[model samples]
Target: EKWAATRAKYPPTTLALQHFDAAYGIQLGHLWPSVRAALLCERKYGALVNNFSDDDVLSDLQDQGCRDFISDTDLEVHLEQISAVGVEGESSDLSTKTSDISHQQLSPLQISRNIKCLVFPRGDITRFKPAKPDKFGLLGYYLMDAASVLPCLALDVQEGHNVLDLCAAPGGKTLTLLQTQCLGFLCVNDSSISRTLRLKRVLHSYTPKPFLSGDNLRITSFDGTKWGEIERDTFDRVLVDVPCTTDRHSLVEDDNNIFSRSRTGERRRLPQLQLELLLAGIEATHPGGEILYSTCTLSQTQNQSVVEQAIHLAQENHSIHLQVVDLKPLTHMFRKTFHFAPNLHLGEMVIPHLAANFGPIYMCKLKRLT
Candidate 1:
């Protein structure tokens, strides 16, 4: 009864929404409404992990009536619109919204810039009429957010590089890395069994059986905070895509989300864990190797501050130095199709907005110097 009363007073979106406002108000003020509206809407724009399908997924989707978002002329013009631009030029009033955002015409940008993944124009996704029953049909594009590929792109995995995907759950980013055909051996790990099961299921459907059982890939259930100790100086590239207070899921999904009274305490501890996990990833990287730290939240505590503190602690505590790899060049190259927060020194973030509605994804890349 107390729980019921608490929920009645606060409502589902209350705590999460208030948390974001307090956490991100300085950075997202005035643009928060549209971001809220986009998150509330059900028909979210998502990407097809194209490389999963053997054939050209983009051309196949196009042939099936799905249009490429980046190539859409309307979206291109809307991107630069004076009023409609912000949140990476991604604002709109919730009061002025339709029942669903996808009801309005919006195109999905090739979130990966075709090199990584493709985004579906909002409404056209329902019109996807696949011609054949194969991997493409079995693998629907909407399984992942359009911007999920950002970290993999930033990681820049090279051929025969040893890689670690710490906290790899559901495995969408893992699939993206495979697209590069990089990795002498990929060590995929997630702490949670349920999430790891989902990751296994992803590999089962999208990946070949021979490959899953082969020497190239090994999935482990390990505490990500201890990964560095477990496998020190082991990887050529490491992707520490740590588990976070997933902003979109937190706001829209009240049940099983982090905002509840019982879970909020653990949520409060995320930054510290994030820092430790990042430091562990740093420890796991070979000297002269690269590591990409990422999160799906817009919180500075989770994103920038975590990266900042980890860089200092990794050096001070272990005598290991790391150099920041500038992500501005990547954001600029991807700007035409996606909306990114301007002037983030540590990394690039995809700002959630009405036009692209892709991400609240933030990533920073660092290279081990010592």
Candidate 2:
């Protein structure tokens, strides 16, 4: 009733609340009042607090009964208080250590070349110039960053682990795991046989290691969802980078009428299909393994909501415990937007404005607790 009243009072603010409820199945009435109050206060007192320093205004506001007049300094003080209370900052020095370890793992040649490429423009490189465009056929493509491939690679892929890339084709992330040189076998499956063959050609370019060679890497054509029924808990890691509405790529929209309807339908249908795919991926994932769920869309229905639903379903079935790895630090640095789920233990979201190139990719890394 309170929620209904609040929604009636402020229609626009309630829209996000309604969307959140529909998407994640959580009722957050207590938080709504505070959120609404904050919005109202922000509108009423924002200008006064906007430029005020801690000493100049927040102290005054507190004494004057405007407790929520949060200035930049007030935010800093709050964080300091929280830090004093032992709440962890999103990125600690541990991230630096991990980054250093990642650097150390790279060969000197790789590091030097990476640094040189960053310092010198690509076309100016002396060893090999950027390839000229092939007029005859498409030869190469570009992705925003290699970091986008990291989640799929870091998924519970260990030495001698059997992995499945359900819907894998044009293999950017599939190749990331192959490069790890750790997996026992990689089953790269796609619905399209032609695309799977293309994936094979791409994987074939890399020198086959003992773990990732001819027999270790198998390309098959199959509907991904059926894998659950055919082979349950068979893979140590599963990558379900599902198809989604490519609205972020609106610049490439060829036909407005067709594209808009398709995009809308994709947006509506994605959450349910994504939830199914994730559940199937989890079914394929061995106990104590992980699955990386990703999409190149910004929709909450496709990203966090689907993950939450999967987690709930998994809990009901006692199949696996979902642990969400925090991608907040990564998203913050990259300026990505994430629509957070109330109950998520871990996840990452990359919004459109953040990426320099193609984007608004949402990714979540989930581990199945044994």
Candidate 3:
């Protein structure tokens, strides 16, 4: 009644976001009230800083919630004002042709460390320089995906560790691993031929030539789940970023229609494949080595349940050496920004939020005890 009366009395543009609040209330349904409360108190924007120097300065900036290091002269201090509007009908001014949107010298706040990310006022970073070619390639300032970086943190790459990214595509986490640690060898593999090309482009665009051509690095196209059969207990550390239902994109819609899964049985298939890929990663990890299982979905069946099932199967097969690695140590960094699933003995979840809408990313770190 309040929303209709307000809308009828005045145009949506004239109202001070009460319409937006109501719209979200309708869309969020059961979750609206809590989300509204969170938003009412939440900071405007958040993002992680990328590729910075001077630890002291970074620390100071992080204290202020600054995330990005744009350039030496133009350190993005803060975002002053931002605006956007939805398009209902075609207008000549609104060209369909896509062009890059850039925001220079805007400050972002640091949210947490594991990957040294900052939070920002806006949820979507469409204007962020994602496609721009930097001179330093991987060494230069780059915005890493928060969800992608988390698994790399769970992997905890160290100097001279042999690593395998079993389903690496678009190479965000692969680049993070290379950037964070010195590695003996890094094998990045993806099953899809098309995605492998994109992965190569991302890597080639970001990475220095030496790292690209070095004997230590290898990029291949293959079925990731067959690694155990090909080379058992091979890598010191492995990252299995298996494909799963990308819930965020699918769960919500512009018309306020939500949770429209066309085929319910489809959900079970991905989890099965995820488990297979995870098991493959485990089998290919050296004794005493670590493996991180990750997916960009909130589904318990895909995330925690998959981890649980894998662990159970391993244990049933007399695999005491395979054990869950607790991630309690790094909880402080992400706790404020993300919701950790309760009683999460084997895995962690990065719940989606209105402030820093990154994920719905679930990760489980496992180690081979033997």
Candidate 4:
């Protein structure tokens, strides 16, 4: 009855809560309220410094409650190939070392230990909403959850790699990929024209005018699931951050939400679509290439089940093989900055907490072998 009353009070969040209750509320237990209550407060967000340009200084963001680096601690890797881990009993090395990420930069505030994103605690969002320029002119940082940037980092983009961001829209992870400055060619695409336009605009904000349209970068409105046919075995790295329920935003905002009355069918079909996208991403990956599959929601069906099915289908139909890259080492290294969900077979989920309110972002890494 109280939940009914609260739902009546906030119609925007009702459908999401109901769906969550049906989906995984039993697992959430008391943490469900933590997610609910955290929604009422300002969100803790992070800033990714623009590696492309230095025209704008943003030191004032640190004063505005930006506390520390996402992970300043040295990562001690204790990860073995995740056994059975829900994907079947096969195991493979996740393949990363503490020495790989131990490099430090001169910046004391945010050591450039590979991932240069900054963490801001709650009650510290005044700088992001209106985007406070502060005393250092325009802020040089791109405001986002520190968690959303993980997939791009884990994708391990390198110089001269031909990269494809298949479902890239509103383009946040795309920007993080750009920060690497390692791409020989980048194709950013989405099925939605509006989203593709928004992605183009996001690129425009951070990218130089000349570089946005040349031989290096290309933007298109393509059916993300059909990408394998369009560019077969082409990219060195691929990022398929598929469109999911967007659980956190779905609860807070009602406009065009998947939980809404108009989109119930769309929501139901998401797992199938996610599975197709992952398969297509794998198909587009060159032999010995890597791909990072991600979503911004917590639906188990949309995440692990989809990856499991894709793994099954990829080998069964096309004779392609994918090695699931274990991410336990990465999650543990940044434990202080993120609250990761336990026992997940395919990926890492940053569970939202009232104290550390961020995410519900799930990412799984894979490598395609011919």
Per-candidate RMSD vs. true structure? 9.4, 16.2, 15.3, 5.4
At residue 35, give the lDDT of candidate 3.
Answer: 45
lDDT of 4 by residue, 1-370 (tens): 6555544454646878877877676766666676657655666777777655554334555666665454455423223312212234224343332232222111211322334677766434444643433332333667787789877767777668899999998888888787766578999999999989998877877766656766889999989899878888899989999999988788778778788777889988999999999999999999888889999888888888898888889999989987777665566556777788876756788887766777888998877878
Which is better, 1 or 2, measured by TM-score?
A: 1
Per-residue lDDT tens digits of candidate 1, residues 33-103?
77777666653444554455565566766665545443344544543342232223212221122222221
lDDT of 3 by residue, 265-312 (tens): 554488888988988888888888888999876566777778777777
User: In model 1, which runs have C-alpha deviations exceeding 4 angstroms?
Assistant: 1-7, 49-56, 64-116, 121-142
Q: For candidate 3, report its TM-score.
A: 0.67
- Candidate closer to the true structure by lDDT (higher is better), 2 or 3: 3
**lDDT: which candidate is best?**
4
- Whichever of 2 and 3 has more TM-score, that candidate is 3
- lDDT scores of the candidates, listed in order: 0.71, 0.50, 0.59, 0.73
Give stretches of model 2 more than 4 Å off.
1-86, 89-147, 153-156, 206-214, 255-267, 328-346
Using TM-score as the measure, which candidate wins?
4
* Pairwise TM-score winner, candidates 1 and 3: 1
